[model samples]
Target chain A: MGSRLPTGWRDVQVAARAVRLVLTRPAYATAAVVAAWASLTVFVLSGNIAMVRNLVVSGPLSPGDRLVLVREQYPFLGTNYGTLEGVAVLAVAALAGANLALVAYHLREHELSASEGGGSLVGVVLGVVGAGCAACGSALLVGVASLLGVSGLLLRFPFGGLELSALAVLALVVSTYWIAHGLRGGEVGGCPVDVGGRR
Target chain B: MKQTSRSDRERTAGVDDGRPARRGGREPEGGSRSRRRLLLALGGVSTIAVAGCLGNGGGEADGDEDAGSEGGNEDGGGEGADGETLESHPVGVDLAEKPRLGPDPFDAPATLVVLDDPSCPRCAAYHQGTVAELRESHVAAGELSIVYRPYPVVYDWGERAAHALEATVERDPEAFWPLLGYYFDEQSSFTSDTVLERTASWLTAETDLDAAGIVADAREETFADRIETTLEAGSAAGAGGVTPVSYTFVDGVFQSPINGSASTTAIETALQL
Candidate 1:
């Protein structure tokens, strides 16, 4: 096995290749996949919120009122996706998710190139943070605060009374630009050619 | 420089052999190892992303379970406790008995009962105009006790919201009309899905009642029956077909059921003012 890989330009070249692949024909394909994933993520997360609301306000669903598991997965979309407005929102959210997927993809690739194996590490951190925020119980909080007339006081602080709407925007931003600068500067930390031809 | 030299030699070796590095071509062992490592890293990152999504899904499902259990816990009052026994008090009216609004066998000279739905826009308009006027002019003066029996005919959501209004009677009888007025004032926001949110918010903000407790109670089918009994009462009195129907009673005798949005003048005339 080849060892003692140099910390330099060949890695940059490989990253450039990845970026070129991303920006060229593969860019469309990557974005399309990411967008589809992002949209589904939004739907699932929102659906969970709706499910909780139903349970809280209506108690256990009788067999007659039980929602179809598969059909209920998309929450708002599943309920109103046939409507024009619902379709429009889903389309917009998917576009935002696509942008996010691009940023995440590039970030992971760059981290993998580093000697420290930080790519997977970064992914773990992101997964924890993203899951926490996406599933935050801000809806109930805000609803309570609005009722209490203290929303201004409670929700103003960071992560104190955070809302789902803010978390969603943050998800869109992180996904769109986490590795934006790295991609633009044409940097890649690791490359296959960095290994000398030793088997 | 050493790495460059190694790469250069490898390229030369390939060229000398009359082959060039090509896409999908067999890689030397070290390059293959590097490709494998790279794929592993990508795989790990993708796995994390997938796990994060799944985690959110799981979290929400868990929350639903918790909320369901919580709701069940508060429903200890059984499923059929009609809130009728809860004593209701209007401003300046103090009696040991539950003060029946509109019409009752309370030995009162006259009772003006308004059958309205929380979801009815016309009822909302009447409440804002006629009902408010009545509250200030007759109710405050003790000339008449205007009782609002929810007709619940506008829609299913309207019935549920009316149940929430009835829920307030059990906890805060003083807030009964105020809660109904709040529902009427924000009438557009009351949907089957949104009734709980709206009720909880208003109760939390405007009343000292436990918002969650109210939600837990209102979610019970028993609480819904409280509103159902009132509906039955309205139907028995021949005032269930259309909402905003006013029934005037003089000395415990039913006079007439005035349908549609009757003006304060028409209502007063029906009350024999």
Candidate 2:
């Protein structure tokens, strides 16, 4: 039944609410779980992209050929992330984010229906923006780190944290949706009639 | 089925343990908008970033680096001997000085030209066989001059690569050979922003060229026309759409597409050896 939420610290709050909603609203959990599965598949495929290149098409190409492909396939990673390998990390982030959002939504809706107002709507918006900024910042840090060490270190671990954070964001989105749904119902004492639980 | 309502569809979409979660059909307008924007932005950034990383793995540099690891690799004088010489001094990204264009490199002692996609699988094989011969023997003798006009057909990264070649020829330490060697080196990393950035660093460190300028020149603005010309030229030469188009130009006349894919004996027989 939390009403007013704090400002600025949006990202952290979203993360907290997302985990809480995973229990009952299995709908959100299903989305998150599916996304997780997809993300893992992409990660594995990303790892094998190199071998696929060598064995299938573009086999044993020259350095020039290799460079050309990198530039075309991944534009954002080129400008940041320090190396081409960061593309895989980005994929993981997307899948994880979607999964968490679904799980959170289901939970939030359940709480709201049971007469608890749940997370504030403003909180969800702020959380999303904060997560985005953090993702960008993390990518920047990886590139800066390359300046200090042998640039190859970037090849080993690129902006993979984006994937992890994405899951948290997904969770938040799900939770927020459910909470709002519950609030519209009689879940909040003020509604008088059970709008959230009407169905 | 009577068309399911939007909310019902959404309910179905949000399946939990094979059951649709019930909702009051009262989605908050403002919250949904924000959520939508955030998701879109995240998806976009992820695609760009991921494409950049895998594309920059540096597989493209393997070939050229193997050849230009030493100064002897550049021993073949720029003079037109057998017309098969390949040099990297003209292809660096950091062009400290404008690349001196001698006679049309295509018109030199009559080495062959393969204006093909840097990432096509067939192109790699040609590099392995006859390209090796054209580069090592004839070019070393200075009897031939090889000109590489990269036409990126296999992927979008091809365009940036073509520009990078021009950049190397125009500015970097006459290390065109090193950059030229890189053409096939990082094919897998092509078209990815990360690979392009990595190439920027590699070009800077290896050739001591201006990395930033080259990147600026390649990116932000699309220099796709240059690639178009190469493609047009290849098509005009009657190169079948299939890649690894191998054709030699002896003196100034354009010869027919040669079979470089054949074994040495087949090529020797075709050459009437």
Candidate 3:
């Protein structure tokens, strides 16, 4: 039977089961764990593969590429323009982590509509896995830059000396905050659930 | 009914109570109906995602045409348009075409083999900015031998399939740099078969090349096999297959370039420019 709910709150059940299916399944749960590793593997490989060549060839700068760069590249590099380009990529990774955390958060709150019991420990695990991906993706960006021997390019900026590995750790911390808070939400925030204790 | 278990009835009653809680209205059947709607919506989202991917393939084909046209216009409009340069420190005589090169421009030997689409504007800009510099300095000085693998992969001005690259190669490799410099400079002015052919004619006349013979040769698909071979080799070697791919033999080992014009510095640093 469908979850017991008042009208207009049906999505609560839908999102709850969605979270449950992902969290509770041993195989699906394991896949999430593997995905964390997989993304790391990809990051390592992409960095290594990118490093073999010494030349950075800006491809045919289509007029559009130039325009797009001119428009976004300014705000991107403004103030800290020289160093920000490197971290612009990391910022994107963090944003992705934040978005996934929000989805996990919504799923958790939605499940509460059904009952006090929502995502199990598996929700925490998957949330962490998503967070790991965000952190690792950013880390990989910096590592590849290093392996390519272009780390010196960042030297010109005032604070550009921050290592890519540090960027990765920063991403991980942000991802952890998002994943933990989103999954941990109100229950952990001290919202009293009927019986599920703190999420 | 299993002796009307207390827990089962409690569960059923919970749904029953939830219905009335919805604005104080009592629809005994509301809960079940709402569940069905939610399920239907979920199903619809999946169906749409699958259908969306298929639709995009067709959309990509259309996008390419628009992208090509838009790029050409943007490129042509920018030329000699001083506002766009990041540094006015450039636009010097070194930017123009020359019959020969001296010692200062490029010290080391560097030849760039670019697989380009004539109508693609990105390719045009790269041609104007980097490739032209190489031509004026390296090729003219006989320090580096440049090769043109005009990969007409994208739609060249909407007609004359493969007409663009083949014409450039067959027309005259010697004059290809100057011709390409001109073609890239004025991409927006010509986007059709007639315009392309007329431009080709003008290039031959301008360079005093054998224009009619080159155009006639291209029509026979003379450079067809060479184009295919080069594109295949490039793909095998991990090229993105987009316009403006450069396979540079820096010290005689072929390698791809890093992404961006700023690579100009990296390149100069690499080659001690």
TM-score winner: 3
Model 2, C-alpha of A154: deviation from truth (Å): 32
Best by DockQ: 1
Best by lDDT: 1
Instruction: Kindly report the docking quality category of candidate 3.
Output: incorrect
Interface quality of candidate 3 as DockQ: 0.04
Instruction: Name the lDDT of candidate 2.
Output: 0.40
Winner of 2 and 3 under lDDT: 2
Residue range B1-273, candidate 1, lDDT tens digits: 012234323432321233322222232334434445656765776665444333322333222232222111111111111111212211112222222443333455656666677766557767787677776776666667676666565555777777676676777777787788788788776678888887898888888998787777777744666565665544433232345555555544444444334456545544555
iRMSD (1 decimal) for each model: 18.4, 18.3, 18.3
Give the Cα-based TM-score of candidate 3 against the true structure.
0.40
Q: Candidate 3 lDDT, tens digit per residue, A25-117?
A: 464455444544443332212221221212221332344443332232121221111234334333334333333333333332222222211
Clashes of each: 5, 123, 8
Clashing pairs in 1: A100-A175, A100-A176, A113-A190, B102-B112, B102-B113
Residue B107 in candidate 2, Cα distance off native in Å? 6.0
User: In terms of docking quality, how is candidate 2 classified?
Assistant: incorrect
Q: Candidate 1 deviates by what RMSD? A: 18.2
Tens digits of per-residue lDDT for model 1 on A1-199?
1222323465434333433444444655577566656555543333232222333224333443334322333424232122332333344455344444444454333221331233323433333232222222112223233435664554333432223334443444332332332333322212223334322
Taking all chains together, the TM-score of candidate 1 against the true structure is: 0.37
Cα deviation at B57, candidate 2, in Å, is 36
Clashing pairs in 3: A55-B258, A56-B258, A57-B257, A57-B258, A57-B259, A58-B260, A62-B122, A77-A81
